[model samples]
Target: MLSFNTTIRKIHLWLGLTCGLIASFSGLTGSLYVWQPEITAALNPELLKVENVENIKEVTILKSVVSLIETHKDSLNKIFLPYREQQTIAIQFKNGKTNYYHPVTSEFLGEKSASISFFENLLNLHRTLGIPQIGKYIIGTSAIIFFIILITSGVYIWWKAYANNLKKGFKVKWKAKKKKFNFDLHKALGIYFFIPLIIIAFTGSYFTYNAVYKSALKVFDNPNTHLINQQKNKNFSTLNETLLNSNEKYALRAIYFPKDKSGMYRIRYIKDRFIKAGYRKTKEVEINEKGDITTLSDFRFDSNSNRIVAQFYPIHIGEIAGICGRILVFISGMVPLVLLITGFRIYRLKKNKGLKKK
Candidate 1:
């Protein structure tokens, strides 16, 4: 059998050629995604209008908001409660989504989703390539190809450099020729970035195929991080009323009432956000079938888990990295494209020289 090195190189070279454009496009979009907050702020500041709310308990406010939504006859798909320190509570329904009164009282601070307020098409382009089902496959394949290309180039370059006593690796003569310069930059940058690119590739792959990571995390029996459907309680009205009675300090991220006696009412809280930031807090509050708040015993902020599970996707996509982290991703993402360009120039020069000799 041919060695693993030979096989992977072939895969990398062919895949790189086939998918380089897709990879470049995906990377470009990804680079933009990291700066979405800044872009949104610049483009539509009014959408993320600022305001203050003083005298509202999270639970009662949440119930009243839900009731309001019900009166509007909106089909509830998801409910988001408000947390302390954040300005707005959100309720997402299937038919026509609605935003409750912003904590901004006394001033008619209006609300909007895709237009004046809370939506951007650019974001959809970043994640889904602005293409949808077809785009996902393209991006997913690009991610895998990116890794394959890196490894192939890395192995060939490293092996070639070290094979000749490792002494020839450092001296790319500047008195130099264009070929020498091109090859040197290609090799130099590749070495500097092999690790970061690999991390990006693997993490990205997690989104394309989640089963692998899910299984890996399962080895330690720690897969219980996600929540399942809740049991329904007989007294939905009473439970809802009781929860409204409790005091909550954080913005809600998720909310669901169970279907049966053994079920629990689950609510998630996150710091006010339409923008990603460094110092953020998240937690979940659980009101059990017995009207017991099992999360942190008293305040919901102290609840151990995120009211919802934000798995590997965001971190993989570099969204978790606030701002500076995104800039790093932008730099690293552009490297492969640079390599592609320089590598071709060198390859063309070498090919012409070989013909001249013949």
Candidate 2:
């Protein structure tokens, strides 16, 4: 019978082979997604940027929303407030299309372009392998395997090195043969980049198993926290008034106009710092046409689990630390592919040597 260490090595090798393709795909696409915001801005500068930003003032939120409704004849699903003067407000419609308007001029630029469509497809492919519900579970399961391999193999590598010579664990034998070099590169890179790689795997798993994360949050957050208010009236003008009367400055992120008599206007916004800073703080206000604040959710006062859940996406994509964080995540995504190649080669060489000895 194989020893415990031998069994774990087999498990790690097989797991890596099984999930290698999908995991590599996720890493490659995730690297691209890290710069999605920048790519979007570059692809559609006319829609995303503006000139004379200094001279431009904030447009009336209610007026712009009303104009969108009158022109499109579609219920306003949400309004994305620009984080910067050069950025444009995105008015999302019930039809699942978003129209970009100059925040200063309120000039209609255009709908989402092919580039945005391509990016969306890329995201879906990354998350679901271009497959829907079933693919998500597969990815989630693979993520768990990744975490297990990281823990088991990582400890084993260091422990075995320590048993041989304590210093061997830290030093790469550059003058060694091809196989030794490969082994050193794999072990060294794994140790050096372990933290970020583990983070990416854990968070990416959360995205794949979001239902599990949501259920876990129920233990901390009030069960009724997500339930929508039933008292909806079409008096959004009053809702707008209440927002205007508030002393605090807020940049709108999204506004959900009531769909029926029972639907409430759910407004999500941010205050303090640009939205590009991952909007570390956010406030969600749900109110009826009567202008009564029916429900208020603020990240500042949220429970610990709630806060973690809210920050999960930003943390996963490295938006929390801005450009530097994104670059780290992008590089981390590529490490697994390197490990897979080196690891498989090592396994093949070991298997051939064992056969020769037999």
Candidate 3:
């Protein structure tokens, strides 16, 4: 019978082989996704950018939205507020089309289909492997296995191998024989990048198994009932009131128009310091036609569970620490591919040696 350490090694090896490709695909796609916003803007400059005009008043934005609603009517879905003067206001329609308008003039510049965009496809593949319902579960399960089983077992195998010679675990023996070099590369990279890999995997799993995380966190027992308010009203003018009434300290991020008579207007806000990479730090509010504003969710004032939940997106993509963090996350995504290659090489070499001995 194999010893406990040996059994763990076997488990780690097989699990790595089984889920290695999935993890690699996810990592590569995730790295690309880290720059999706920038890349999308670069690729569609005419649609994304506009003239850098002076102070765009709330009345101007309201007029633009009202004009858009008059033409588009009930098809309008959500309106994304421009982050800067040069950025165009994006209005997404129920028909899956996103039309960009001049922030100051409300002139239609261009439009794109959500289903056909390159990044949209890439995001779909990353999240669900381009498969529908079951794909997310598969990716989520793989992430869980990667996070829990493979990482822990791999660490144990490494510790068991290098407990006596700890220094060897940190460095790759580049001048050594092919098999030894491969082993060292695999072990060193795994040990060095394991923390990031674990974070990425955990966050990915958190998205897929959100209920599980929330349940584990004990946040579901008493949910925030005040997050959304449903009523029978559709007044486009309320958007202007929402804009005017909004806190001037917080920069408006986006405004989600109600879909039906029962829906309420939702507004998103971000602090000035976090304007660049503030995915998790945003504050959301919902307003009815009566101008009764309800605080939906704010990261700064959220419960511990809610705050942790909000941090998952930024942490997963490395937006938590801004550009430097994103760079680290991008590199971490690529490490899995390298580890997979070296691990396969080592496995093949060992198998070949065993065959020769036989």
Which candidate tops TM-score?
3
Q: In model 2, what lDDT does residue 147 have?
A: 71
Model 3 lDDT at residue 346: 86
Q: What is the C-alpha RMSD of each candidate to the true structure, in Å?
A: 6.3, 4.0, 3.9
If scored against the real structure, what TM-score would every candidate get?
Answer: 0.66, 0.83, 0.86
Each model's lDDT comes to 0.56, 0.72, 0.77
Candidate 3 per-residue lDDT, tens place, 135-254, comes to: 998899999999899888888888988999989789887899987888888999899988999999999998789988976876443465443323222333465655654444466777
Question: Which residue ranges in model 2 land beyond 4 Å of their true spot?
Answer: 52-63, 73-75, 83-86, 163-167, 173-176, 214-239, 242-249, 258-261, 272-279
Query: Candidate 1 has what TM-score?
Result: 0.66
lDDT of 1 by residue, 239-288 (tens): 45654554445555667645555766676666543446343555555776
User: lDDT by residue for model 2 over 1-358, one digit each (tens)?
Assistant: 9997778777777877767656777888898888777888788898887665445544454466555555665356777766632277787788788889866556889998898788889899888888767988787777777776754576675677666775676678999999999998888777777778777888889887777887777677665555433333343356556555544455566677777767787877676424354646766778876776744656766555657777777788887887788889989888888888888898899999999999
- Best first by lDDT, ranked: 3, 2, 1
Give the true-structure RMSD of model 1. Answer: 6.3
